[model samples]
Target: MMSTRLEPIQIGAPTGRLSDWVIAPMHFNGFAGLPTTRNESVKSPKFSCFGHQWRLLIYPGGDRESSDGCVALGLQNTTKESIEVETKFIIKHPHGGGDIRKGWDKVARLSPKGSAVVGDVGSARGYNNFALRSTLLDYLFDGALIVEVHMRTNKPGQQSAPFVPENPAFQNMLKDFGNEETADVKFEVGGTVESAKGRRKRAKTPTNTFYAHHYALRWNAPTLADMCKPGEVSPTTITNVRPEIFKHLLYYCYGGKIVEGDLQSDAKDIIEAADRFGIVSLKLEAEACYVDTVEVTLDNIVEIVTYADSKNLALLKEHCMDFLSSANKIEAAEKVSFDDIPSHLMKDLMVAFARREGEGSGNGDTLSSMRVSQLRKLAHEKGLSVDGSREMLIDAIKDDEEGGETES
Candidate 1:
């Protein structure tokens, strides 16, 4: 099969929430793996913005008052004196279109105490219910919550729009991209991947071929460019992805957007192909679509979670955990055949199960936060003696699981 390179797109700088006034990013990496009890929170490092010391505190599960659905946020006046400021949070939605909620423009009189936002901890002036977990899951990318805080600042974000000089001649440079008139690059798709380095081993007697310009191809997909070195005249052979899928990827890289219908057809495949080509945006779209559109249930939870963990798709894994938490944990554990799941990911499932049922944090020696009832129930079910303190109960369970003595 042969196809020409797609036309260029008009991609520009981001046009969502402005980041000039305050660019404090709250990066909660591996949020799904670090299971926390509802109301339990983590703090981003203190950042300086608007000539003030500020820190972002996020409750991964939910707010202190209502931990069921809301993921709350808090901003502290780290300086000595109190300050009254209007605030808004722009959740950099993982799936792409940022979730910027209106009417959250809160003007609070924040004080300096034990990282105090209002009168005291859990008092007024803090972000009470910043976002909901159900909605946030769709926003998250790779199980990370990336948020940008914008404050009412004395200075305007920008004095004037930056200038973009245009010359009709610039487009002409790429005009020959799809034209065989001078296209300098060739791609052969569908073959075997080299196991050692994870790159495709050039197929013997390649069949499928595509044409593209060297500069355009190199800029869009570097792996392909690297293979077609500076002076090489041979076609860069690729394997593992279908030629049709490559067309979508190549088109998107050249400034085109993939249609929703194509993503709906084979989002998982697209996600894998996009990731392989270092296409972050497409990967995020497929991931977000799969979690948002696909129905998650006990029957497919194991398969999905396993695939997610393998790909390091934290956002999808988090969504899977949310579904399992809502479903019966006992039944979910039974339906989750440990044999299919890799040894490493089994711990995540157990931790999520324990977190939902017992409100436990991620698995470790720090199982003290887990409710005694949940631990005792698990221990009793394992036919182990449940006569001990919280630490002792944890040790017993850990021993059983580690020793491979516990049943699925």
Candidate 2:
């Protein structure tokens, strides 16, 4: 019998043909003996963290956050291994022609695989709608290697502008996303990744080969102690990620192979890094942190937008809005100065209100300050039965006064 192996296809390069047909075949081979490890006897709770373990907070695109708080990871969705895991599609366009409601409804109906409805940016009022989950990005882009989506814009004909690669302001808007690239000035997808000590280096390989073998690869670990050497981890790579996060990322460098009994947080940071870099497998791992453990908090709300670019938390952002509104009603709310909060969260709040209030009429008609104040007065008359309403009304009044316009 003759052997047949297809030639390697390089993605993101201009010359190669985009893969038309790729498939994974199941095998019926007999099983081999399982090998045991020295640390196999010891086990810890899954996702547990302790001394020396590191995890990263990552953005969907796999970049670090600008605030120096969260780590970043880039993910690829096609390689996910779990049969039971849920996936979603997120779309973001800066210029803005797509109707948020219509677009989301279309995705739900049109998706080849029925996906559960996750939250979206347009779900809230003040959101840019251009911001979305990176997991959704892979799906919406649909393996195009490079995608250019049309946006809605105020400018006539500009309503359909492209979300170009050149439009990387969003990527650079955060420190972590911008920090991941090597400064060599050439952007090559899947190029070699070399650590200073020569302990870790990643090479370009085929997706087919990667998935076919069920094999996972990680770069070798290098420490700051070893980084000073001439061939050790590059200074550029070292500079992008935090030392602690990188220290944890070292585990992945060793082939996604963690010590059997290690805590989950140890991998959290690393998984975050992977998500920033578009390493799909890592994002899936990091998402485990929130499963059965999700909560609503203003801090976490800010963190989701600030660190992960995940707008899937529509409810959380709503809570933040309500909290801010309530606080403002009781006493003037501090002007929201952060670009991330005022720009994004406000949008979320508005959309949330509209969704609850009904769009364009009914409850929606009450989105204005006068309506909020009316609701507050009613709540006050009724002993503040509405959660956070009075404070929200107060904030509206304060804003009106500050703007030299009274809310009638």
Give the runs in model 2 whose Cα sits over 4 Å from its true position. Answer: 1-268, 284-304, 310-332, 335-345, 356-408
The TM-score leader among the candidates is: 1
Task: Give the CA lDDT, 0 to 100, for residue 229 in model 2.
Answer: 34
lDDT tens string, model 1, 323-392? Answer: 7667875987788775776666445556556766776454455554455546667887997755444446
lDDT for each residue of candidate 2 in 167-253, tens digit (9 for 90 to 100): 553334322322234221111123344453346555444111001001112222222223233322323233333444443343343
Q: Looking at model 2, which ten-residue stretch has the lowest summed lDDT?
A: 207-216
Estimated TM-score for each candidate:
0.41, 0.23
Against the correct fold, how does model 2 do in TM-score? 0.23
